[model samples]
Target: MSAADTTTPTKVPLPRQAPPPTAPITPPGRRTSGGATVPWALLAPCLLILALVLGYPLVRLVTLSFQEFGQSQLWGFKPAESVGFDNFAEVLGDGEFWAVVVRTVVFAAACVLFTMVVGMLVALLLQRVSGWVKTLINIALVASWGMPIIVATTVFKWLFDSDYGIFNALLSKLPGVDMIGHNWFASGPEGLAVITLLVVWGAVPFVVITLSAGLTQVPKELEEAARLDGAGAWGVFRYVTLPILKPIVVMLTTLSVIWDMGVFPQVFVMRNGHPEAEFQLLTTYSYDKAFVVNDYAQGSAIALLTVVLLLGVIGVYMRQMLKIGEVE
Candidate 1:
């Protein structure tokens, strides 16, 4: 062994194992190389249904708005004649139409403001509750949200009915109040107030539930730190909580505005296309002119205008919210 080349035994290096075959890299949500295909295939049916139900009607309505779609055309076995922008011109020329548009804008603003404020309070309160209390409140809110719009409108109409209504009965009980024979439905302003009440009441439940869910995702440690720094309840919420909740609040507010602006059931039940033209909203007005007055083209034009206005308003809101978020 000591001799230079005599009997030296060499240790053999173990055969280098190829790095364990790298597991085929897959993108999240994909089970295979063709993962995206199946999901899209599954979604195709829903998309087709939506196109048939929503897209077709929207296109038809838009086309109808540009035609002379009077009752004769609507009923007769003939297509409507293209009248260009005549229906829009007539609708836009009416000063009364503009008034309703302005009134709808104002009404929507008020409803959104009311809904957001109450919803914010309810969401904040929910944060402080626990266990069964929270569960019970959630159940109540869900029930209210699940209620049908038409049924809710009927309940509200009955409550505010001039004769044998619970609301008037309560008003009559007030000190020195002679509201027993009061006709709340006869007055436009008062009637509008009832509609607003209905809108706000029905909307707040949704706002509260959505906002509460958002609040749960907020980091509690941040809130506790703010409190530890001698920040009062209002200070903590205004400076810490609200900043985190801004996106949710903005989203809910935008939805509320859209819903209230296009509200129909409550207005229909309360006003029913009466002489109180002052209380009419876009939806009710459009329905009246289209169905009640038998002018489909005019109604479609108004509806198209409503869609345009809603889109514009929502776009502005989203832009503003995004800018504010970026600045903060």
Candidate 2:
């Protein structure tokens, strides 16, 4: 056809192909139901294990706390009788229980304070030391952390023994000191002080390792910047390093409190399984009530109360963690 006449067959545009399917858009701050369930699904096995391991004992403890379950019922000679709030009332009313509670609190606070302070100091030292020295320190920490509680307690007990303890011998060698036959456990406060040292000794390793790891995550550049701004060692740590390490500190403190408060083997074994009234912590107090005095229900009630108190601490920890998460 002639060029002009070739007005040609007009080309027709093919319709645009539809875009390929895509995932549905979820709104901000929300997830798809299936996506949301993934975390729970991943956690189900752990939750199930915890429920199986802890559920029955917790339920039994609560039930026993509300009943009159003494040696008679314990051996099946008589049925456990429901006593409503009697067990709780008796425990709450006893002056000794309050004393034990106060002692436990003070002991835990002391342990936590010493643990954090020593741990932080060691962690800072680790940062400044040579590689080999840091490795050596870490190895020592791990070794101590791995030591069994019973073994450690025995070692500490011998160290502070009334007659032949090396600790006493060393003290006696000092000028004008006569500690050759000193009995560390003769008084309640003195004995508790020794146990506190042991607890702090054992607990320091974990805190050190954890804090050291946390310190590694701290941005060195931020610390350097702080230094450039005329910050001293303490200032850099307080303003820069500490805020970064707050969560770890909180977690370690909470765990230390829980562990120190629940200490039993130390006091029990130190006193040959019969911690005197002066040496009694909540754990030993409950043990004395349940086994020594054969007051099972009252012991359960005391233990339950201790659990509630610990739960409060855990609640505070969770709240702090959530706040930190939000801030981040």
Show pairs that collide, candidate 2. Answer: none
Q: Best candidate, TM-score-wise?
A: 2
Give TM per candidate. 0.86, 0.89
Instruction: Give candidate 2 misplaced runs (Cα > 4 Å).
Output: 1-42
Window of ten residues with lowest summed lDDT in model 2: 1-10
Q: For candidate 2, what is the lDDT?
A: 0.93
Instruction: Give each prediction's root-mean-square deviation over alpha carbons.
Output: 4.7, 5.3
The global C-alpha lDDT for each of the candidates, from Candidate 1 onward, is: 0.86, 0.93
**Residues 1-328 of candidate 1: C-alpha lDDT, one tens digit per residue:** 4587696689999998788677877878867758668888999999999999999889988998999988678778677799999999999999989999988988899899999999999998988888799899889988888999888888887887777789889988889887766777676777777888889889999899898889888898998999999999999989988988888887888888788889987887666545368788898889878888889889999999999999987998889798887888
Predicted candidate 2 versus true structure: per-residue lDDT over 32-118, tens digit per residue: 666878999999999999998999899999999999998889889999999999999999999999999999999899888998999
